[model samples]
Target: MEKEEIIYGAHSVIEALKSEKSIEKIILNKGQRNEFYEEITQLAKEQQVKVSFVPQVKFRKYENLNHQEIIAFTSPVKFADFETIIESILSKKESVLFLVLDGVTDVRNLGSIIRTAECTGVDAIILPKNNSAGVNKDTVKTSAGAIFKIPICKVDHVHDALFYFQSSGIQLIAATEKTDNYIYNQEVNAKVALVMGDENKGISNATLKQVDAKVKLPLLGSIESLNVSVACGAMLYEIVRRKTQ
Candidate 1:
């Protein structure tokens, strides 16, 4: 069955309305009103998007989340072809910071990664259609609704996607403790795609071999590796920081 898409929080909902994206409806908390609420209402009216006010408790049931007094249920994030993603990066004149997950199945980890990706300004996140977590209620709640703002594309095979990006002049970098290369020292300015493996087994050898470079996050203590989400955040922001500097 197809899962529903949810966008919560007043700021996120407001942005969705202001943008050209399609919104199914706006679910606001009952008895809540102020400048923000009024503005959202007017904007929804102008856009002709339906608005439904429910009790805080009832609205919580829609997302099973702490809706922050506002929530917006929209259609699934629009998925596009690989050619579209490549064209988008080319048009923006931005070095691509693409993330490809091999087989990360945990919903929470995927959700957290989505949140971090949005904050780090990643170009797009590519995941395999099978053996990957699909965005749902828990994911939306865990992402704090940031999934609504980020673009997620599902591919038939991650390896094919990597090759497609590589052919486009995008370097594929892998994060694994097995590598001698340090992620912090890597040149992040080039058109690069960062590949993170699943939490349990890390990257498969077949996938690892395709990587242009393998990098590791420094472990200061006894811990061998960072959690998938944490490692992704560290690596992503490092790329962003270095590129902008």
Candidate 2:
């Protein structure tokens, strides 16, 4: 196993976060009571660092080290800011295509989406920082390194990106069955933001209400719904086909 560079001490971990270091994961002591731990927790979240609250016994191997009940593993990947990337894309005088993910938490599914999005000419991917999956080794491996080829913007909320896209003339097209529209029925052109929802729950009611179009793939088999990644790939390819033909 490849050993990870671990950061011990609460203050050191916070400093790493403040410096915008690529932190892969942070494991906190579930039983340890510390005033600074909560602040560290919040900072880890703001930086999109994966966090885990394991039992104190899990820290036995690190008993010789001063972990302060908080240990952070450094990663090599970093994330892009949602607004900055979108603004840059909007500044360009050309059509834009974005994939917006809402509450797709599985890393493998996220990886598949990124792979397909990259192949389908998606300009960038906009994901919610909290509910969506973050870049990790599993996602990287699953994506077959395509994760690095695409630009992923992490926003505070999915709707924040959707609203901004709409205001900037990018149509917010969602993949959901709640509407009567099909993906093939709409003429996707110019600036377009394709929104994919959760694995089981589908798109959130709030998001579905605000999107410019709620489109779904026609279901003909006994399967009630397609996997989120598969469904997203289908929608992306459909858009590409429409654009080409």
TM-score of each: 0.68, 0.87
Q: Write the per-residue lDDT of candidate 1 for residues 18-74, one digit (tens) a residue.
A: 894555567777777766789889988876666888776776465666567777766
Candidate 1 local lDDT, residue 174: 94
RMSD of model 1, in Å?
11.7
lDDT of 1 at 33: 78
lDDT of each: 0.80, 0.84
Per-residue error (Å), model 2, residue 67:
3.3
- Residue lDDT tens for model 2, 213-233: 889999999999999999999
* Best-matching candidate per lDDT: 2
Q: Score candidate 1 by lDDT.
A: 0.80
